[model samples]
Target: MIAKQVNQKAWFMVLPVFLVVAVSAIIPLMTVVNYSVQDTFGNNQFFWVGMDWFRDLLASDRFHDAFLRQISFSAIILAIEIPLGIAIALAMPKKGWGVPVCLISMALPLLIPWNVVGTIWQIFGRVDIGLLGHTLAAMGIDYNYTQDPVAAWITIIIMDVWHWTSLVVLLCYAGLCSIPDAYYQAAKIDGASRISVFRYIQLPKMQRVLLIAVLLRFMDSFMIYTEPFVITGGGPGNSTTFMSIDLVKMAIGQFDLGPAAAMSLIYFLVILLLSWVFFTVMSNIGEESSNGGS
Candidate 1:
């Protein structure tokens, strides 16, 4: 057989995308890196500070508390959203007009602007005017998010779930759709229960997409800002102040650019590291699944 000539034309096709990404992403990243290492007093004034800001951030109790709160929020969000999404997806019709209707409805929340979501929820949770808050108050519950830390936390968590669970649902639903009917047929032929079919066939097949869902949710939740900020304003004694909010407060509120930049870099790294871990674990799981299939 004659050796086929390798196509060089594909490189030309990809070049524009590379150039666009470099300009939009890499240049801004370099700016952040520069800011992370330097001090700026005012217009055009700068001095090198090395790792001072990093050390200070690491030692600060405020930073530690924010970190812990962020981690906890992310964990809770993942725990609630992933399972709930899966359940909703499973319960949805396998085929019909209902499928598109369900998908479109689910996607509606995601289509809303982030700031708009925050504003809507902020008004929605007001005890006097909001349906939820008014109903809760009428039911004799003390449900003032403005004064109660627990209430604020609960509201924020619930709001996040309402806003983002749709994403998880969509991803899981797509994964479910991609699964071949032959597997389900075989499971049915063997008299497998619903649970057994889900466990042995569905769950395994959806692992890769679920991994993507988990990573996306984790990163988004961890870096969340606008919703909580608008609703709680990091209030109720900073009980709802996540790392992203704190970073914004430092960078803009305090005008501490150097430290803020350092913290931001660290924050970016933490996200990158966690994403890497998720990717590695998913890759291993995929490898094992492939080996087993073979």
Candidate 2:
């Protein structure tokens, strides 16, 4: 029997990333965890409070409302962006000078800073000297996002769609480009309808990329804070205050560090669980897709 030697040098390559994560993510997470179960007074004084903060947060109406709003917003975002992205990607030119043009146009929105996107939309949605708001007013529509909950929600959603749908389009377009011409040729030889070709060929081929798009959009939307916070200030009376905003309000606005830490942990768990569920379901689908006889 021959002995195989294992290289220990690979771990050295991974050590830097491990140290970075420990410094950046894990250390902060542990600090939060420590705070979640303890009460603190000024001057770094701390008293163990067990699960009191978590219990209070779980029982509070504010947390409940924020959770519901967060999930709902994420759902609406996914529903709108996924289908809209697919439609746009399908319509975009696959080749020629037009391809680069369309890609650059889509990529432009994504390059803007998050706060800048919110600022742009804020001004863009104002009735005075703002294009969208002014146009809506001229059309006789009452469209004040700062005061109206519905308008606030719509503005936030639209801003997200405009900013992030480009990501989905690019991912889907890449998936489309990767599909071999042989599949389309065979479809044409079979005299397949456009709808049939898409259903059987393009869709199946795009499944992996579509899964990636969904997960990315879902996580990003769920954690969205900067854009909405800047646009709405979590106002129109807390109607647009999702979990992230609520956490900020608790931690910074009210100076409730213990409760904020606990709430943050819960919020983190919810996202973690949902992402796991999505990954599991999508992985199974991918497996079945590969296994199914064509």
Candidate 3:
């Protein structure tokens, strides 16, 4: 018997992407690592500072507050959007001309540029001239995001939901559409209630897509910068100043490169860790569902 030799040329085809990633991601990451432990005074002079920046960041009240704010914001939106997305998906027309219309409407929000969404909302939320703000004020509600911290948070959170919930809806809709008709027929023949069908069938099928949507939204919301930056400018006195905003303030606004680099590394690690945990939990649930179904 002759053994066939494996071709090694596939790696050569992948080489370009590897090099591109190294240049774009790895190089900058190493540069940040270099800056994380060094101090700079004018004239490009640098001195080693070891882990002092990381220690300070861990001990800083501002950092802790920003982190808590970021976590809270992510939690609030995830709580709202996941169920909201699932509901929207379930309510959508599954097979009709209306499906395309509904999908297009959902896609429209996602197509808007992030900065444009922020600008549009910023203008749309002004109590003097903006529609939402003006209407609320005319109704005798004191809704001033600019001068009010709670109002500022509310505005930002709403803007994020409007811009991003569509993504979840689209994902869940795709997951729902992929469900086979035979399962529905079986459920109908068995006289299963709508709630039972959903709980036992639809929810299990949607687990994977929801997992993807959750992970994506978690990372996006956690690292959010542009939308809130343009909308609230992180304010009504740091009420909405998230981790990313604070990191930018340290790195660019204050020129604290060492601390900023350390914070960024920590931020990256946190997202990585959390995403892995989400993926693992969802995977285990999926496996258990499959096993139980079997």
Alpha-carbon RMSD to native, per candidate: 2.4, 2.4, 2.6
lDDT of each: 0.92, 0.94, 0.95
| Candidate 1 positional error at 268, Å | 0.6
Clashes of 2: 0
lDDT (tens digit, per residue) of candidate 3 on 213-269 = 999999999999999899899998999999999999999999889999999999999
Please report, as a residue range, the 10-residue window in candidate 3 with the lowest summed lDDT. Answer: 38-47
Q: Each model's TM-score, in the order given?
A: 0.94, 0.95, 0.96
Better of 1 and 2 by lDDT: 2
Q: Write out the backbone clash pairs for model 3.
A: none
Give the local distance difference test score of model 1. 0.92
Better model by TM-score: candidate 1 vs candidate 2? 2
Tell me the lDDT of model 3 at 58: 95
Q: What is the lDDT of residue 284 in candidate 3?
A: 98
Model 1 steric clash pairs: none
